[model samples]
Target: MTKTDQSSAIPLDTTARLPAVTYVLTFCIAVIGSNSLVLGPIAPEVARSLGTSVALVMSASAAFGLGTAASALLMARHVDRLGARRMLLGALLGLAAALALSALAPAVPALALTQLAAGVASGIALPAIYAGAAAVAPPGRESRTIGVVLTGWTLSMVAGVSLSALVADLVHWRAVYAVVALLAFGAFATLKTSRYRDAPAAGSAPWPLAALRIGGVKPLLVACAAFMSAFYGIYGYLGDHLHSALGEPVSANGIVALVYGIGFGAAALLDGVVDRLGARRVMPFAFLAVAAVYLGFALAGGSFAFVLVITFLWGLSNHFGLNVLIMRLAAIDPARRGTIMGLNSAVTYLAVFAGTTGFGPLYASQGFEMAALAALVLMLVAAAAGSWRLPASATPRN
Candidate 1:
């Protein structure tokens, strides 16, 4: 193992349980993920409540993504200086305040501003959460540990999105944000009282540019960009296609999302395979699997049943791809993990924007099949980038 990997690995006795702080970090990620995803399901209700168009309400989500990308690129390096625990605490507090403000927003502009603030907080918190996850991982189990934390995304999809929609229907759209605010507050309190302490790394780079210069960083990031862009591009318009093209109801669309989340969470059982095989060895195949899933989407877009099955496979492949990519990046340079992960988050959100916007014209001109094909092309690019063989010095010791 590389010295960087060894440094982050926690020595544990046999049969010792994971640190409590690990679960706390997972909850923190779940809250952050929920905030990012909640806007989608509740957009119509929010628009109705604010007396605005649905598109305008959705623009608030775009604002959040923009803010998150900007903050991650600019401020994430601070985690290396301030320490992950401290940065996370402050960011969570900021997120809670932003969510509360979002709950009280009476206008679309106000809601957008609040979401932007929340995005800023999330940008900082996500990298810290990732770095903290790595820092707390037991030796030889890094992939599985990170995978456990990533299931927070699944939770956000299944429980967070579903519950927010239900709450908005049963109560009010504002209640969704209010409840998320309370959850953020709870996460903050738990983390604050926990024993997790991720001390700042010594001799870390001061700028993201230096992290880019690190061996193996550029290609991995290239793969990350392609991977995330493909996903958001296809996913952004999937529900619309199902409703318009296939005559599926809104509830049916929700079922697809739920099934996808179940598949994502279930794939955590296979994280140990990545640990045993090494991420560098497994990532190429994982990307290819995602590409195949996209191709399946193109072929099966007309059949709701087939689409549901393929969506499950999509979630499973995506989980493995994400897990391996993060494992490789976190193991690349311990000192620069915060910056590296920040870059990852920036690329991801930027891709979210790119995919959503880029695929719109295609989806409009041709149809969902064409968009699916386009996503397949991007995933192929990701697979190729992931397959690049780095020099021995640049390769992560997975």
Candidate 2:
């Protein structure tokens, strides 16, 4: 093992078991979710408010996603030297400013710029938070803690999108950004009072100059990309699908988002399920569930409630499997947690961007059923590939 790996190794000790680390994880994940939901349902309204086109308003999401992808891959190397707490604080400050700017943006390009800034901040925050979790958690509890932290992001997506949509409907869309800024401010305050400290700098590994060469890292990145591609393909256009196909209102779609969020939260709580059932087994099953959900969605015949339930199940399985993979990566290279996580984030966001941008025209031209069918096939293929690539040796046990 590398020196940094030895240093990052957690003992089953009391200090590592403190709750403050959990608080930090929760706060950070919430920020991710809120940032994710800032667009979509509100895009049209934002466009109208800014005197621009919906397409232009939606481009902000793409810009943000691009920032996320680029920052994760490029910034992974410097996280150790920067310190997790300092990195997180800097990210938060940048995000806060971006939110404020986006909320008050007078033009489409300016809004996009602010969104990109927020995305960059979030990209940095993600690796830091993951590294911190690995640094602080007790041995064997990495998966569970990672699950809890990631659940915060899922919850934010569910609540943030739905709530922001509702708030935007009642008031101005700009108020949504303002609210996010305020929530982030509150989270920053909470983190300030917590006793969580940065990982010790001694024996820390310098950032890898090349791409990840560790066991499981490459395949893990591929799975991350594929999984997120399927995820974003469906979710990025879920609102339009609901309205255009099922004739559901924006508010109703928000409610559906809440249901999906519940599923993610439920799955995170079941992190131990991965430990008990084994990562290899649980991951393939989760991917299969996503495929099944997509199939159900394709055949739902526009049944709003049925589709909502399908989405919920999809969220549950996707989160469960993804968290298991994250835990595996952390275990394989504990010293390079930030770099590994950053790579994962980069791949995932790249997939998301592709799904969002590439799938749109296809969906618009082919209709929801065809789009859903394509996503289903892609997910199933991803599941098969993941199962095949993952060796039997890596399977986890309760």
Candidate 3:
């Protein structure tokens, strides 16, 4: 085992169980997370409403990613001392305001700005949410707790994206944003009104670069970036692609996205899937599975049914793989969990930024088929990096 993996090994101890109220923190996560994928379900309508092309409208998507990258890079170190409750509340409030602003945006530029604000809020909130889950977890249950909380993101895909798309089809796209605004407000209220307690963090700050210097750390980071780039690159364009390729309605796109979410949530919550089979065993296959699915989607023609199946399978495999990756990173340094996780978040969204921006024009020219092919190349790299570099010990339960 590499030194970092050795360093990251967690012990089962008699730690306190997480309080029931802490689950509110998870809802807060779902609301904030909706901001990231909101554009995916409604991009075409957003483009038409703003008098822009889907490619240009994607700039708003890029802006959200950039905003996330900026905040994560600048402020990740201080998250522990800042307190999870404080950061999460602040970010949720900002997200509510930003979503409301998006509802009223006059043009693509205005919309992009609003999304930028929303992205920054998400970038700040997510790491804190993960850290908070760990802080309150009962030792050995930390992984399960973090996984449950991540169900927030999964729910955002299923409930938030699908429901918003349904709402958008019924009304205007702006109404979708309005509903998100209301929900964000409701999430904030739940957190604020709950019997919340501030989880304590270590007195010392996280040094991400220090962890990065470890033998396996750099490879894992690369693997993370590559994985997200491949996954999100296609995901960012899935709805628009479906619309243009098959003349499918937004509701169809929402259904497919919900299926994808179902796959992810199901895999993440599967009983003893990770523990029995182990993450090391699953990770490589997941990496290859996502790549193959993307390639299949690229070649599958405009059959929405085919696309839906591929999308669902990709989500199932990819979410399982990502959970393994995240567990490894989270275990890298317990004292600096917040900082490491924050860096992980930055890596993820920035890769989303790169993939979304990089593939927008590619999708415009050679189509989503070529775009998926491009993402496949990155996924292959992720597979290799993760397979070869992450030590066996990285999977603790194994």
Q: Give the best candidate by lDDT.
A: 1
lDDT of each residue in 1-398, candidate 1, tens digit only: 45433223345232345677878888998999999989888999888878888989998999899999988888889888788899999999999999999999989999999999999999999989988888788766777888899999999999887898899999998999999999999999999888787778886456877779888889999999999999999998999998999999988878988999998999999988876667777899999999999889898899999999999999999999999888888887777888988999999999999999999999999999999999999988998888787776665543
lDDT of candidate 2 over 1-398, digit per residue (tens): 23222123344332245356776677777877787776887888898888889988888988998998888888865566667777777777778888988899989899889999988988888888877776766554555677878888776877777677778999999999988887777666666677877753556554543546665677666677777887888877877888877788867777777788888888876776565554556667877888888888888838887887787887787787678667655656555677787887888889987887778988899887877887887777767656654355643222
List all candidate RMSDs to the true structure: 2.3, 4.0, 4.3
Q: Sorted by lDDT, highest first, which candidate order results?
A: 1, 3, 2
Candidate topping TM-score: 1
User: Per-model C-alpha lDDT, please?
Assistant: 0.88, 0.74, 0.75
Instruction: Encode model 3's per-residue lDDT on 83-155: one tens digit a residue.
Output: 7778778888998999999999999999999999988887888777776775665544544566677777887
Taking all chains together, each candidate's TM-score versus the true structure is: 0.96, 0.87, 0.82
Superposed Cα deviation of residue 78, candidate 1 (Å): 0.9
Q: Compare candidates 2 and 3 on TM-score and give the better one.
A: 2
Q: Is candidate 1 or candidate 2 better by lDDT?
A: 1
Clashing pairs in 3: none
Off by over 4 Å in 1: 1-16
The 10 consecutive residues of candidate 1 with the worst lDDT sum are 5-14
